[model samples]
Target: MSASELVFPPGATRRDWMADGILAVSLSLVVIAVPFVWLGGTQEPDPRVVGVSLAMLLPLTLRRHAPLLMLALVSVAGALHLVLLDVPSPSLIAVPIVAYSVARWVPGHASRSVLVIGTFASLLGPMRWFENTTSGNPSVDVLSWGACLGAVLTPYAIGRRAREVAESRGAEVRIAEERYRLLLAEREQQGRLAEASARAVIARELHDIVAHSLSVMIVQAEGGRAAAARNPDVAAEALDTIAETGREALHEMRRIVGVLRAGPEAGERPTYAPTPTLEDIPELVARTSDRARLVVHGEPGNVPPALALTIYRVVQEALTNFLKHAGASAHATVSLSYGPQHITIDVQDDGEGVEDPTDGGGNGLRGMYERVASMGGSLRAGPRTSSPRFRVLAPLPAPPPSPPPTHRRS
Candidate 1:
């Protein structure tokens, strides 16, 4: 909502008029009875004094609605009463009431004007009251002046304090609302970031599964077709490899699709095949081609599941790149080294291929790099100066130590 909508339209409500009306009527009746009380109703009171008193008291109806107008009316009548009458009346109570109303409802400049008018009245009203009786007693006049000044200033101070407190509360409410809006914005940004992360994972998974599987399948189909006339067994074996590769690709695709479709509210859990790990690297290399060989430098230890997945993807992507970029007769070697602090992988192919295998603007090498880097690992791929035309070297952090087993007390 805008600021204008939060503000009320100008003018008093029915409730304000009704409440102020009652107060004005009640005070007027008391003001009317004051002259009779002064004389004890034993004699007729002066008509002019009663008339001026009513003028001062009657404008209380506009005290909150039109405080400045009410103050003007009361102040004029008060001046008249001071000039014409010798005694004070109950109608004078309206002075403090008007002072408070002006301070509470009027703007700063206009409200401060009331204090000037009030202070003068405070001094003059007392002097007027004691002009005939005091016989020039300084102490008594000063005390009366102070008393009258207190009446006007006390209510004015209270009104100003009330306004300040209300403004402070309004400021607090605005701050709390602003903070709530910021919190909502922060949550929305986090949701968008999570969605982007999920999409990246999907893209990377699809690339790995489809790219590697299709490359192997294509090579097998070509070799199988070429050997169909000469060697029936070789052709048959190649067909089997293609079928197995296709089925594996389809299964991995179904896993990704099922996860995308399932929601927490659906109460459905799709059973997915276990992810490939470091132990599965040999089978992966064998399936790729007989041209690629695997070599290990150190003993394997307990590897974390995530690190295992990273290693498998890295090898898969490297072999895929080798097949895609290297010549037909090129031989490749995949070497793994396990150490106390890190695990290293090297996939090298002695093929006449592009100088920079990572230079092709394909997502295959990029996905491998991302997968490795996500596990606090580093990957490098390019043509080497030695026998290998292309080489991909990666060193990944070792898994943390497992907690010791606890024996049963019994």
Candidate 2:
């Protein structure tokens, strides 16, 4: 379907065959001319000489196109010329070249077999010629035959090995390219998933900030309107509270926007306002308490702002849930314990717990779980053993060392 899928039949190009034909024809002409020009006319040129040369040169044109047939034709012509009349010629050069072409270009097992057989046959031609010669020099004959065989087989062996090496290297390159492509694809997928997670987190923070603030504003406005006709001072205080709450909400929104704008280039330095911590717990309780009382225990210690913020939010959300679901007579107890390695916060209400409080498919509890997990801590929220309870426990990361103290004595 694609260009990569298209397959080409293996063989030499037309250019290759044409080049070999030209070389073979030129060499034959030179070899045939040597006897006439250089040998001083001692032996007359045979009429079959032209015919034998043509026969040898013609078959080479198709050496790559039809290698087996071409090798057979050249070998038969050379052998015939040798047996009938001894002729000194270079026509035998075509035999080995054709053999090498067949081995290098032909794709199938059958072609390779043909190439091997033809190579052997080509080698035998010189051996036969040397053996039948009247010359008694055995060493010369052996060396000449060996040289001929070596010339014929060497190119074939070298070409075959080159093709094998090229094929192996090509395969390795393809595998490496494929692996790189897959790794890039995986990284892109992970990046998309991370972006989606970040957007979801931002959405939850926006919802909590807007929903909680708007609810409080509505309640304060109604209270002020009702009290205005009866007590001007009380209505003025309610108005002031409303304004303060609105400003706090705006500040938080601005902080959220700033955080969202901070990109990767913002570096590892902390940005936005310091997150709300346990010190802000009294304010959180007072906001939703109405007629309820707030009590806290434990010596204050430095805690990671991220974990502290999580604690504050958990308590806030728990109180909000209690306000909405619990009766008006319901009251809550907020407790905090700072340990050597862990900080624990509990928001317990003396009212009817949910039919199934554990069923927290909403993003509120899920967000809390994610925040706690990010700090390498855990959270559990359900009914207390004795009374209704919503508990959150988080392990605080070790504090960074304080700067050296400076003191001046009188």
lDDT of each: 0.85, 0.67
Give model 1's TM-score versus the native structure: 0.82
Model 1 worst lDDT run, 10 consecutive residues? 1-10
Question: What's the distance in Å from true for residue 306, model 2?
Answer: 2.1
Candidate 2 lDDT over residue span 348-402, tens digit each: 6777654434333566667767776777777776666875544434444435545
How large an RMSD does model 1 have?
Answer: 4.4
In terms of lDDT, which candidate is strongest?
1
- Runs in model 2 deviating more than 4 A are 1-88, 106-111, 127-132, 135-145, 218-243, 258-271, 291-294, 353-361, 385-410
Clashing residue pairs, backbone N/CA/C < 3 A, model 2 = none
